[model samples]
Target: MGQDISQIDSNEIQKMLQKFGKLDEDNSGALSAKEFMQIPELTSNPLVERVIDIFDSDGNGEVDFTEFIRGMNSFASKGDTQYKLRFAFNIYDIGKNKL
Candidate 1:
C-alpha cells in the first residue's frame, strides 16, 4: 500500500479529494467508520478498526480531510523505512507499549 508521497502531484490530490467526496455519503465533511469502510478493499479487512484508529490522529473517531491526507502520506514509499515500520507497529500495538 506504500506509495511515494512526493509522487502525489496536484492531480493525484484532486483525485483523492474526489474519491473522498464519493465515500462521504453523509456529506458531513468527515468520514465515519461506516463511511470509510465503504471502500471495497476495507470492507473485508479484519484490522479495519485499527486502521481507522491510526488514521484518526485526533482520536476524534472520525477522519476529516486533513487527517485522511496525513494518514495516506504515512504510507508513502519514499518515507523512511523506519517510519513505515513504526507506523505498521502502531497499527498492531494494541497496548501502545511498543511491544
Candidate 2:
C-alpha cells in the first residue's frame, strides 16, 4: 500500500486530479457516495458501496483527493502485484476477517 505516487506520470496525475474535480460536483474537496456513483462503471456494480468504503480509507464517509489517488494507484499496471492482491482481497473480505 506504500506505492509511491511520484511513480505515476505527471500527466496522468493531472488527468486524475481533473477527473476527481469533475466528480466532486459539490466542490466539497471530497467525493460523496452519490458522486462516486456518478461514474458509469460503478453505477451498475453490486459491490459499489464496498468499493467506495474501501477507497474512503479514513472512514470519513467521503473519498478525499489523497484517498482517491491511492485507490486508483492500486490498479495501476506498474503497481506492486502483492499490494494489488492485498487490496483486492480487502475489497472482497467484507467480514473484515481474512478468509
Candidate 2 has which clashing residue pairs, if any?
none
TM-score of 1: 0.81
Over 4 Å off, model 2:
none
Candidate 1, run of 10 with poorest lDDT? 1-10
Model 2 over residues 27-97: C-alpha lDDT tens digits?
99999999988877789999989889888988999999888888887877877788789888988999978
lDDT of 1 by residue, 14-68 (tens): 8779988999999999999999998677789899898898878788889988777
Clashes of each: 1, 0
Task: Give the distance in Å from residue 29's predicted Cα in candidate 1 to where it truly belongs.
Answer: 0.9
What are the lDDT scores of the predictions, listed in order?
A: 0.77, 0.85
Q: Which candidate number would show the highest TM-score if scored against the true structure?
A: 2
lDDT of 1 at 64: 86
